[model samples]
Target: MNFLYPGFLFALLAIAIPIVIHLFNFRKFKKVYFSNVQFLKEAKEQNSSRDKLQHLLVLACRILAVMFLVFAFARPYIPLETGADPDKGNLISVYIDNSYSMETVNKEGNLLDEAKRKAKEIANAYQLNDQFQLLTNDFEGKHQRKLNKEAFIQMLEELKISPASRTMQQVVNRLQQEGDSRKNHLVYLLSDFQQNFVGTEKIKSDSSIRYSFISLKANALPNIAVDSVWSLSPVHQPKQAEQLVVQLHNYGAEDAADIPLKLTINQQQKAISNLNVPAGKSVKDTLSFGGLEKGWQKGVLSIKDFPITFDDELNFSFRVNSEMKVLTISGDPTQQFLKSLFAADPYFKLREMAEANINYSTFPEYSLIVLNGLKQPSSGLAQQLKSYVQNGGSLVIFPDLDAGAAVYTPFLTALSLPVVQELKTGKPVSSSIELKDPLFKDVFDQIPANMDLPIVNRYFSYLERNTAGKESILQLPLSQSLFARYPAGAGKIYLSASTLRPEDGNLSRHPVFVPLLFKVAFSSAKEQPMYYTAGKDDLLEQQKTSVSANQSLVLKSTDGTEIIPEIRQTPGKTLLYIADQLKKPGFYDLKRTDSVLAVLAFNDNRRESDMRYARDQNLKDLFAGQQISVHNSEKDALSLNIEAKNSSIELWKLCLILAVVFLAIEILLIRFFNKTKNIQKP
Candidate 1:
């Protein structure tokens, strides 16, 4: 027993007041006449015994009232928990695991809902004298500090689960830093063991702290998932073939049954096939197209199952990349070199058309038309070339050894090129090339001039092409081997004084070979964009974990004391999600409606053995060694149960009770004493 106000023991000296008042309780004896003495003596002898009885009764009543008052002042109470904190104790760090998987339902239908109810009851049961610290998955700024009940609850409400993941080892690190080896501390973890959570075993630091792991998701339903799809082979080309190979997976407790699969492209059925895969294993199958046009396209793959979330369905798209059909308007074999390159590429379809002889509309379907060793382009061909360049087509020109300036003038002029300058007796030579340009990215950087092949010492003239209003990409060092060019409206032009024959030794291919034709040609090509399907497993190829969960399942229990799941993995010490651990007591769950086979973590639970629920031993041990026994004389120990304890209340109800008792005692004593007086009188 303990008194809340031990200082009230001083109220016991109050006994002295009643004792002194009773002993000297008197008015001055009034001096009276001598005749009064004789009558006074007779009355005194008769009522003397009665007066002594009244005096003794008054002394007993006064002492009893004083003792009761002292007891009331020293209020006493007994501790519910022996050795427990009536005032102070060690701090408890509660880490709540709030992750997505906690959303999973148990047989009760609500995992987090049940967890919160249990947690609050636990908290309320603990005495208010205990101090606590709250924690969550995000161990930053908030939840990382110590607080009282009101403050701790405020931080708890602010907690939310992130898309990121967490592990026990990461959380143990923070606790190890804050925990003192000399003092007692406990960490309570509450979370659902989603397929990705880290269990308690990986917490391997050699600290003397206690930990408890309350797993949130127990007895969850088995789930299935979509794994991946491989790229379609070009060899499977058919107007009716939309070939995309794919794989599916099941993560059930037991093997799953094979089910039929349907495919949809741009909202229409392209192909359907049944993929036979074993539980925890994946299977591959080819899906073909019904009939579809050429271009980039999108599609969906789906499956049916309860929870509707972890089923086999994903989003994907692929491009047909229509092949380019090109027409070479000349029957020149210099055509063979260029023809072979384009012919080998699947995207380019090359063919030789008749020379452009004034009629040009017959080639509208051709993406580009080339000229080699033919008459220079006429007005109609020049106009057609302008349209093709504007419409994003490419062209290559190789001049004849004796091709005159007048024949090629209209073509160059229509391309917005300067007038051509004739070469003098000496042949010019090319010194170097530009490697930074994209056209030279692959092989153009240092292609040696093909000067050894043909040496035309006296065959053609060189062009002194005008330099006004032009953007030159390459310059031939000497008067002999330079290729200078620029872009016009939607087309580009090149002026040269030599022919395509290796003998010219000054062609763009020889030294100008790099920047002259190839550089300009590479720039004119169009670009294509690529897309990878969502929910594909390859996105997780290098990832350490692969996980799936019910859309309705959350990862942390409410009141945050349950165990979060451990992900599958090869073992080691690692920190997941932001390297922070939540061991607080609260509810934690997940968001986002998409189901994905994501890689998660695996952890150890060696840390869970640390919790000991220590109590405050200071006061208990202090009293155990002392042999003191304090008490109230009216009874043994102090108790407010006495009716006198309520006597101090100024309320009329208490006053009425006292008034009735006081009058009854007084009247009965007076009546009995008067009867004694009558007997003495007779």
Candidate 2:
């Protein structure tokens, strides 16, 4: 047993007062004449012996009462085998889960409110001088420092529901960083313990710190969430048909049927549908909409869900271009096939440049660059095109058959494409087409058995080596590739074996030429991510834009919240660091001074959408090697439990009770002894 305030033990000296009073008779004896009778002598002897016994008994009781009283004031307690010493000041770190999932209700009310109450109770269990650190999912800078009891309680009152969420390990790591090393450290985590909280692996904890998990329980609730969404069309055009795919997930045990889903674009209703999602599974549905103007389109997909509604709606954004730009760099001035094909439609703005007069600086402005028989391709042009394709641009290469292998080998090698080995003069018809590939998907309504495939008269056979990202769109006899698509970093490269000359086969004028080239051109438009998660996606990436050294980019939200993110320029893109700035979900415009550069969408993380919680045993198993305790939320009065766990068994209250009992014994002894003497006299 240890004493909280050992200095109070000095009060034990007061016990000497009772001993002195008993040893020396302080009261003056009154001389009486009634003591002369011989018969009273025998009674005097018996009374003298009984009187001495009663005096000794009364002194012992008085001494014990004083001693017990002093012990009570000293606050004695037995130290538990684990945890910090109760005598010293403690640094307690309490983590309250204020995530979106904490909005769930139980018998005690909302989980977040219950967590706050329990946190206060924990603080009350300790001394007022003990320091406290409050941590939430936001991980604000103010929470990093320690606060006194009053300040900690004030901060707790100000906390509300936040969109941010964290795992168990992250909370532990933050707690470990706080507090003083000399002081005893104790941690309390109050949360509903969602399944995602445990993360993928076991938790790593410090052996010196004692951890207690107060698991708050909630009623079982069925939940359905809008998991994700994506556009089927890679490129968006004005007044064009577009299909969007939305995924729905049912986290409940029973299947959900006829869940109403709605899609809105620019504050106008676009499409509506109903879906059936199975238990613990996901289902996808497609919505078709059109007539979008040439501008930024803010799209919102929503579903009707109860109890947990944060993840019911998803926000997304995309851009619809008014015209597609196509650049053609031709070695032969009279190569009019591509120029005439694209010029027929006003939607395609075709720009033709000769080999010697090509402007290299304007490569990023076009959606697709068509190389029409570039005779003697230079190393500089190849390097520029390589970087363009790798940075999400699309390119088509029609190699000049008359050019030597030495001139073309270096250009093809730089782009990681197969080099031409030898020219074949025999006419070979195309064998098969990859009809199921995404490039050709939905292009053909029906396949004909006697379809006319592209024929090649004189073509170069490539000496292929690496076939990792190569997809053969058109194949010749003997498994030779006539045309294929190669995935280069973020973009794609389409290579054809023959040029657009009359001497070559009719591939340039074939029926498949129109759809094939148009599909590639349409796919060249860089498709940014439709949406980003609020907390998870802190970095926003965009195509590199020229910004003056004095000017800065600002992300302005719909509600007039603006923030200047840190910019980081890379080879072909710019990265903006938006750490913890975005909390709400909606559309935000990236602006340069007065002009809007792009529209970015953000949505809340859906990890908190699932209402499933981890069991006590599961948490114990996660922290198997650590000294952790799990508290049940059903039990009220957490202060007593915390006091017992943190400081071990306290004996001060028991000492006080014993002190009262001894005083009562002293009173009874004096009363009984005096009654007996009076009875003997009668």
Candidate 3:
């Protein structure tokens, strides 16, 4: 038991006043001659006894009333927990969830707003000099330092919803890192308790810090979101038919029908489609649009959804080049088959160069580089090809008939590919194509078993084992690799074991050669991702090009937010990190001064779109062995069952009620006992 103001207990001494007054009642005695002695004797006995009893009873009541009144003013209470001293102040840390999920509104209005209101009340509950800290989802610089009461309140007022998200465990970890372990620490968490964000397993029960969870739950409602978007073709072609596939998800219980989806390119409406999504499921629909203009174009795929508008619109950026530049370096310029293949297609701009005259500096300008019948692979050319592949350029290698193992081994080793071991010269071996591969997808409805396959007579075998990124696209008889594809860095390598000469079995003149070469050229162009998530570590790779003396790259968002990100020059690519600059989801432009270099789409994290929330029981289970209590946001903070000294059970109100009851009894006894008074007889 304790008193908030124990000095007021001296008022209990005032009970002596009632006790003294009851003991020393002074009255003038009037002597009267009574003739009837028998009647007088009986009346005196009865009246004297009743009068004495009433006096004692009233005295007890008056004394108790005074005592109870003094005790009430003292404001005594029982400490909720006896281990801690009530006089000691607390080190308080309050975490308010300010993620996109906090935008939900209920009767108390926005959850974030309500959380701030409750947080302020919590701060007011503590003493002014008590240490305080404020934390949010952003984990900003301000959150690291402790603030005074006034400063903490100001921070709470300035808090807003952010695209970033942190789990419950993260908040606890942050608090632990910044909290004062020596003092009695208290953490008050106010949030909607989204289930995905509740990573309580990462939290350990700490005896030093007490936790209080204030759950702010809104009405459960359904939500629809544009999960993602992808194009039918990986590479974008100018003035060609393209399909944009939009993926939709329903996080509700009911089915959605006839949901209108619109696609816009370069601020112009391109295509629209209607989709039906089932409850707790996902669906994908394709939007066909043609006449794609050359150069960079910003595209947006949008749909109508209630409440959650963040994921309603999906933005993406793509480019359609005027023509695909093919740089073919040949040991023999008389190889007409190599020239005719690329020259026949108008979409392909073929530039043939002798192996000796090839300039490595101009390699980044081409989408695909062909190394045709190179008699010997020079160390300089091998190093240049390695840098080119790393910077997102495709390479197709056809070994010369007399090519040496030593000439190409160093080049293969640099790119983490298999080296040439030995050259085989024998009867023609038929080719077996991988029909279900993405390269051959939709190329043929069904492959004919008896179809004429390409045959290789003279070929090179591998010296090293195949890597995880290496896949055999075409296999020869006796399980030998005819054509293998190896992914090196951001680019790919298509290596054929056989030469392209007539003596090498006419693989270059086969019908399968045309589409195989075309697919390699088409797929070489780097396809930009449909969208990137905000608050994630993402780097946008741009092709390295010759810039003017004063030109520099800059990033600008659709909302007029811009920043010059740190540019990292790697070999043949420019890497720009936009994770820090992507505060919100929208279209952002990578430009050189005023000229837009590339368009990049960013979307908010869809993890918050799910409406599921952690229940009170779930939280309790999460902190089972810890000193924690959970309550609804709308309830009073002080009303919850907590271990803090501020939660003292006040006995003042109970004492005040006892005081009133005792005074009433004292008055009734005085009034009733007076009726029996016999002053004349005495």
Clashes per prediction? 64, 0, 0
What are the TM-scores, per candidate, against the unseen true structure?
0.37, 0.90, 0.82
Count backbone clashes in candidate 3: 0
Write model 3 residue lDDT over 1-682, tens digit each, in one string.
Answer: 8886789888888888978887788867898788888877877887888889988999899888988888898888787653444456567889998888889899989988989888888888777878889988777777888889999999887888898867788778888888775666788898889888885473664665778889998877778998888877756778888987789999888999998899989889999989999999999988899888788878888899887787788878888877889999999888888789988978889998898787888998899999999876787888889888987889999988586787778777876778888888887778888886678876777778788878888898886585677788988876678888888877889998988888987789988888888888888876666678877646876777556657767778867888776677776577887556567877888788778878887788888888889999899888877777888887876555545425456788899999999999988998877585554543
The better candidate by TM-score, 1 or 3, is 3
The candidate that wins on lDDT is 2
Ranking by lDDT: 2, 3, 1
Global lDDT scores for all candidate models: 0.48, 0.87, 0.82
| Residue 54 in model 1: lDDT | 81
Off by over 4 Å in 3: 1-88, 199-207, 410-416, 449-451, 537-539, 544-552, 569-573, 644-682
In TM-score terms, candidate 2 sits at: 0.90
Candidate with the larger lDDT of 2 and 3: 2
Root-mean-square deviation of Cα positions for candidate 2 versus the true structure, in angstroms: 3.2
lDDT of 2 by residue, 345-412 (tens): 77899999999898999999988999988887988998999888877788999989889677788899
Better of 1 and 2 by TM-score: 2
**lDDT value for candidate 1?**
0.48
